[model samples]
Target chain A: MRFGSIIKVALRALLRNTMRSILTALGIIIGVGAVIAMVSIGNGAKAQVEAQVASLGQNVITVFSGSMSSGGMRGGWGSAPTLTIEDAEAIEREVTGIVGVSPEVRDRNQVLANGLNWNTSVNGESPDYPDIRSWKIASGAMFSDQDVRSVAKVCVIGKTVADQLFANGDPVGQTLRIRNIPFKILGVLDSKGFNLFGQDQDDAVLVPYTSHMKRLSRRTNISSILIQAASADVIDKVQKDITEVLTQRRKGREPDFTVRNQVELAQTATATTQTMTLLLAAIASVSLLVGGIGIMNIMLVSVTERTREIGIRLAIGAHGSDVLMQFLIEATILSSLGGVIGILLGIGSSQLVSHLNGWPVLVSTASVVIAFVFSAAVGMFFGFYPARKAAQLDPIDALRYE
Target chain B: MPPVVKIEEIHKIYESGEVPVHAVRGVTLEIERGDFVALMGASGSGKSTLMNLLGCLDRPTRGRYLLDGIDVSQLDRNALADIRNQKLGFVFQGFNLLARTTALENVELPMLYGARKFTTKQIRERAMHCLDIVGLSQRFDHFPSQLSGGQQQRVAIARALVNEPQVLLADEPTGNLDTRTSAEVMGVFQKLNDEGITIVMVTHELDIAHFCKRNLILRDGVLVRDESVSNRSFAATELEKLSSAEAAAKLTGAKS
Candidate 1:
């Protein structure tokens, strides 16, 4: 018979058993929905990690002093004083791949602005600090190099500090007291949002490192160093150069410091996110397998129920392939319907979850296509046995069946 | 002249476990073009087996069977299906119309299976003509469930005649209908036979068997009698008289 007639027959038969068809399609619906939802959540988590790593800035390296032991005391909270302003200056002047360098000395203290006091970390650094860390001034202007040279009391406030210290007033060129010392706010840094580590980037204060050491603390030592490479391609070489310089400055005691490259951090985060995506997809694949099994079961039942109809068709001059194609088409229609419903549910559920949890959910076209194709394949793979069985049935025996 | 169907010493054995049950022992029969014949037998008398063999639905075990001059017993299953589609049409006791299809579509089914590339309008026109022949022109779009037993049988007859095959083989066509409905269906067969189309029917009712011009009676896998029914014409008056008599007998029996 014609292909259209066969499709019409299959569709009619499926509609005859509406409840059963819907129930069978539910398997595929759940399977595709799980796949999309899981992938979206996994991708969301990966994006969160990516944003965290990107917050550190590309082509940048962070150097921190290694922990130290007190004299004859194990497990002491002492840290080696290896990083210094001189080391930072040497890297900037001698390293071929160095773009900018900033030595930082940080301390936490209560700050008073217009009689509204708040406790926040104050980081003392040079004019290149914002450049090395990829922080931009949202308003006013960044502290100039002349301010660092002249031990100027100008400072830059983070968004959180700006919000807490000034409320509705513009903090630019306003005086704020840090550890009882009055300082003028030069600018407010842009918001960097929150990261995976839950650290709020908009809650610190920046000032000239030289002034903080000489005038505020009466010390010339630096705690950490931030270095920006000329480009991502030369990050490793620049890191090696900085390591050598720090080692030499520390008197060959293995530099007593650790260097962290943002490239490595970003790569690790990417690998972690991809692994998570695969793992979630794998878990979702189990549902597809179960859906396949459901299709197989339903097809087998359909074969049994339609044995007489099959016999009638065969008696009326239908070939075995026609019978096989009819059943196969029925299976395909069932699963395809399930796939469409599942896609809608998956997208809606992902959006709902994202809204409720305040997490980012991504639904890529690739995921949608993959889920739909997989569901159809599952239908075919599971529908084959029943179709073959129907094709192989003896016409006489099938007609004789009640 | 080419014979419509020829069976030569055909044997069919049914195996139930290790024992063999011979359904058709060694019987040969020939039906010519435009001949209206009936196979009469009780249950398990092998007449149904002979019909199946003639229809190319089952192969003879040790003999040759030719349908429209082709040796159908030697052909493969697919070849047999092709022959059935091209040369033979069938009606069954159960009126096996696809339950969900409309009457018109069911009538159009065999033509769809044929090799002719007919447009949708042509197919519908032909199907409507066939339905008109079977006196079901008004119920073209009704499903099988919506029709009565007699209407469903007429629809089945329409389906059988849609392809205009060389032979129409009906196995107990009126087995499920009442006596009046059965006579009405037999009238359709008689009219088609008068139009020079060959028909071979299997029926157990002697009254129904008298409708055909020839009869082949089977007894225990063998032909007991094959005779021409010269004075057994199926006149409408005779059928009405017989049906009234049957109804009167049933009424008297019920009263007793």
Candidate 2:
């Protein structure tokens, strides 16, 4: 007999129970669908994390002041004056792989401009702040070292503050009042969207460290220090070197600063999404296994129901192997058909999620192919025992079955 | 030509229960080409067992059997399947047509498993021809559920003949039909027999057995009588007589 006819025969038998066949394949449908949808969403989340990391800065590290203790009462991080501007200069001078360093102090204040008032964060930074944080000046110029030395009241406005303070007008040469201290806007920084913490990054103002300490907050303590490593490969090494230098400068007491690398932070963010994706895929695979079991159960029932028919075929001339192949082909067709439908369902669901949540979702061809092949293998694996049972039936006994 | 079926001292024992039951004991029979023979007995007389053995569906426990010059008593399952496909045809009492299938596809089923390669077109043509031979040319597309009992049996006969086997084995072919339909089915068999196709049938009805050329009676797991029919009955004449009787009965009803 030709192989084509065998397949034709198997297809005809399955068509006899169309509704049951579809219901049987539904298990695999949901399984593969869930698998594809979950994996795509997971991948989209990971990609989003990567983009956020890149936008934050490349090959960068931040050192924050440690928690403080006074009279056995501990305070939270940044509660005391632990890091200073001199520490930033010392790290820049001591570390070999350090490409840039900036001491930052932050305070929230109300700014008055064009007869409008808006509350925004004020940042005190040095000339290397732009290089360390990958900020670009959209217009005019940045504060020079001379401005920091003279504590000149010159500032750079971010995109959000610029839009609010000047609207369509140019704000580079305009003057704004911060805490009743008048400062000239030297430039506008380009827009960078949101950070990993979901905070708007382009909603602050920048000024020379000396001017922010003397004119605005009137404080000497720095909030944090930003460092730029020359390359991503050397970020951890640079962090270690800075930590070692800080500990030595503290005279063998506990270090008053904690150094963090961007690479480690990115990895932490990526690990979360990766875990979620793996967990979803694993759960979906369990349903797929259940679907396979469904196929097996239905196949066993079909074999028993068609016992006499099988006997008749065997008596007429069909070999045992022929009977086995017929059932096997039926199962494979069911699963592959289910797989195709599940793939379409998965893609549709992924699109729906992307639309509803404004999330990025990618359905790769490799994942589709893998899900399809895996379903096929599941069909074959589960269909074997029943087919063998049918093939091994004694014709006399089967024919004599009432 | 050599005998189509030669059986020598074949014994089939069933070890299913605690005590063994011998279904067929020392049954030896030979059926030549073009022979129309009927094996008859009451229930549990081993006639069905003998028929199963003749069809090569079961192996004999004691004796050797040859079918169409091939010793198939000890052959494996696949080898026996090949022999059954190439040389034997079977018709069951239930008509055994696959449900939800058209007559044409039902007739084409046997050829699907034939060792000889045949194109789909050829298989269709040959199936149509066989259905026409059984006088069902117009009902090719009707499913078994739509067909009457006699039409279903004719479709079964067409399926059996499509493979062009050397011998056709039928078990109670007319057990489910009315008298007129039984005669009609017997008429088909008689015509096929006249064309030199060997036939071996099993029937409990002596009247049904009378239509064949010879009768072999089994009793108590042994063949008790093997004799040629002294006065054979022709199914065509019987069918004519039945229709005439029906016509007379209808006339009487009209007069009343």
Candidate 3:
């Protein structure tokens, strides 16, 4: 017999019980729908995190003071001021794949300017600090290395500081008081809304490290060092070289610095979302499995319910294979039809979520195709047993069944 | 020409419980073309079993059976199914029409399972023609539930003829119908037999057996009698008599 006619016969049988067919397909529909929605949301979260990581900097590496251990006393990363100016200079001189280096020192203090006072963080950094951090100066140029050498009392304010202290006037070349000492503002940095840590990045001031250590805070050791590699491919090499140099410089003492690259931080940031996406997808697959079982259950019931019908077909020349194909095709049709509907449901819900909450959702073509094929295969896998049962029935016995 | 069905001492034994029950034992039979035969027996007498074997619905445990010049006794299940599809047709006592299906589609069912491929238009045309032959053309679009008992039997007969099989087997075809409807259905079979279609039917009713040209009686898993009828009954005359008798009965009851 032609395959088309066989399909036609299966479809007619399914149509005879429309409500049962639809209910049987519902399992797959919900399964695929959940998988699509969950995966979309998870992907959106991962993508958002990756975008944030990119904003931190390109090909950048940071060295924070490791948990310091001296005579059994310890502190967490960044708690100890262990980095010195000589270490920064040594890295810049010895590292071959680096583009820039900036020694960093930070403190939070109440500052007064334009007859108003606000408390904010004050960071002391080198001339290459803005370049290494991928931050741009909006109005005035960054302080020169000559300024750092002379320990010039010059600084630049962030957008938040500029708004607070220099709100009524151009902040460039304005004088701001820090720790009861006056420093000239060189420029206003461009606005960077926030970092991944949810901290307001623009709520701070920048000054030469020499001026910060010698004039403002009056501390010797630095808190951290930011280094920029020439390219992404050279970051690992540069980090290794810096660690070696630091370890060698501090021989006979425990290593007091921790090295991290931009890529590693991004991976750390995205790992949670990745795990979440996989976990949600795995749970959704359970529903798909349930859907497949539903198909199998309905198919078994249909076979038993239609034993007499099967007998009639067999008596009138239908091959056992023909009967088997009819039932198998019925199941496949149910699942594949469910698959298509589930895909639509998934896309619709994800789009709705993206619209209502403004979350970035991506439903790639690959996911859609995979879900469809998987549902179809589920139908086939679960359908085999019942079809075989129907095919193996004795025609005479089936005919005589009440 | 070879006989349509030639059975050589076919035996069917069921090993369901401890003691094996021989349903049909050494039942040898031959049916020629264009002949209408009724197989008669009481319950458990093996007539139904023999009919099943003849219809290819079951295989004999020991026998060499030939159908339309093909040795089908040794054929596998699939091969037997193919033979049935191409060369045999069946009508069950329940009228076994697929529920919720139109008469036209029911008639088209056998052709769909047959090895011969047909275009959609051709399948429809053939199904319509069979319904026309059975005088159910007007009710072609009606479901089995929408049809009367006799009308449904006629539709079943139409379905049996759709694939143009070599033999049409009916197992107690009129078991579910009233006397008048049974006569009406017998009329359709008589007409088809007159057109040279071979028919084998199982029935215990003496009157129903009289409608066929020959009768075979089974007793205790064996064929006890096989003979051509000397005085056959015509369904046309029987139906006329039944309606007239009903008319007279209605006339006599009016006074009461």
lDDT of 1 by residue, A292-369 (tens): 899899999999988988887777777888889889988988898899899999999999999999889988899999
Deviation (Å) of A302 in candidate 2 = 2.4
Worst 10-residue lDDT window for candidate 2 chain B reads B247-256
Model 3 stretches with alpha carbons more than 4 Å out = A65-71, A77-82, A136-150, A159-175, A243-256, B251-256
Error of 1 at B24 (Å): 1.3
lDDT per residue as tens, model 3, B45-143: 998888888888778899989999888877888788878878987887899999988999999988887678888999999999999998999999999
In TM-score terms, candidate 3 sits at: 0.92
What is the DockQ of the complex in model 2?
A: 0.64
For every candidate, what is the interface RMSD in angstroms? 1.4, 1.2, 1.4
Candidate 1 C-alpha error for residue A84, in Å: 2.5
In TM-score terms, candidate 2 sits at 0.90
Error of 2 at A292 (Å): 2.5
Pick the winner on DockQ between candidates 1 and 2.
2
lDDT of 2 by residue, B132-235 (tens): 99999999999999999999999999999998999999999999988888888888899999999999999988888999999999998899999999998899
DockQ of each: 0.53, 0.64, 0.69
lDDT of 3 by residue, A239-298 (tens): 999999999899869888899899988988899899999999999999999999999999
